[model samples]
Target: VLRNLAHNQRNHTSLIQAGAVEPLVAIMRNSWDAAPRINAAVAVACLVGHEEGNPRLQLDETLVDEILDVLDAACQGTMRHGSFWTVWKLCQGLASLTVNDKNKELITEKGGVNILNEVLHDSHYNNEAAHRYALSAIWNLAFNAASRLVILKTPGLVDSIRDIVHKSESIRTKEAAKGALWTLGLEQDVKSLSETMAQDAGWY
Candidate 1:
């Protein structure tokens, strides 16, 4: 219900105005039910994605940690067969959280870069949406110095990303790969990176 409501930016603003962020955070913080927690997480992710000043001031590291735990569970296939959408949702959540400076550091501190990198590497054969989400998450994390260092430190991650950039035939995957590499400072200097999306390919 809440996730659908937050699908539109204007509706998300209205929901935020109606004090939705607090309860959504509470749900993610307290609910043991995966469905409720993921739903609330999507909603809060929308709020934090708002184009305003420091929207993440309303959030904290605990939220990113919680999202990562669920993401790891999804990657581990512990969530009702571990659907691709679930993994994508969690990765998307982490990507959004990286917009916050503190959350970016926390993501590396919490081992999120490796988690996303693992997804990127392992999903290369599957060509799932989660594959792209993992790439996007890695791209986002590369914006932070600490997180970028951790991503660079992750074995095979750089090779995987570089490989995707030159080998991926899918435009979506190739562009996302380029974005990740560009942010990681491996690609030749370029203008702003697009938040590329594709249902196929993986590298980080």
Candidate 2:
């Protein structure tokens, strides 16, 4: 079922838009077993950030938080890609639900900043598709929530982001970093990030 959904690009997205998302959200909410839930989470992620809206599911306020909880649990596990993908989707959904500042605070409050930092630094997850989605989600949040407070609050965040921006050859990673840096801007934090970027520019 997952293969069919994942492989057929058009049909896969169509189901999500057609109200299958609520069931996926339910799976995440009730399932204690991680793998099935992870699969469901991944499916949920595939729907997130798409340009479709489901008016029926609009009343479910718990949707975003439930998805985020699953993603958070997945992160604590060893399966990096699946969990990371879940987070990427949740971030997209959250972006859809709230404005930039609200989303930023929600991401930060949910410890998304730390999770993104870890994923960015984890060499193993870098090449995975799920990780790419995670990076994009982080990029969106960083750009939306770019401010001095997030930088100051999340220790090692600035440096980790700088390393990815300057050192990685992957254009996706670089672009994600750029979104983050663009958020950081020419503020005093730039001095520190710039130094790290220069030092690590050739490492990756």
lDDT scores in order: 0.68, 0.53
Could you say which candidate leads in lDDT?
1
Candidate 2's TM-score reads 0.57
Please give the range of 10 consecutive residues that has the lowest summed lDDT in model 2: 52-61
Give the alpha carbon lDDT tens digit for every residue of 143-179 in model 2. 5534246654677776776666556667766765666
Per-residue error for 171 in candidate 1, Å, reads: 2.6
Please estimate how well model 2 matches the true structure, expressed as its whole-model Cα lDDT: 0.53
Segments of candidate 2 deviating more than 4 angstroms = 1-11, 14-19, 25-42, 52-104, 125-131, 143-148, 186-204
Model 1 spans with C-alpha error above 4 angstroms: 4-38, 47-52, 56-58, 80-85, 124-128, 188-204
CA error at residue 89 for candidate 1, angstroms: 1.3
Question: How badly does each model clash, as a count of residue pairs?
Answer: 0, 0
Provide the lDDT at 42 for model 1.
70
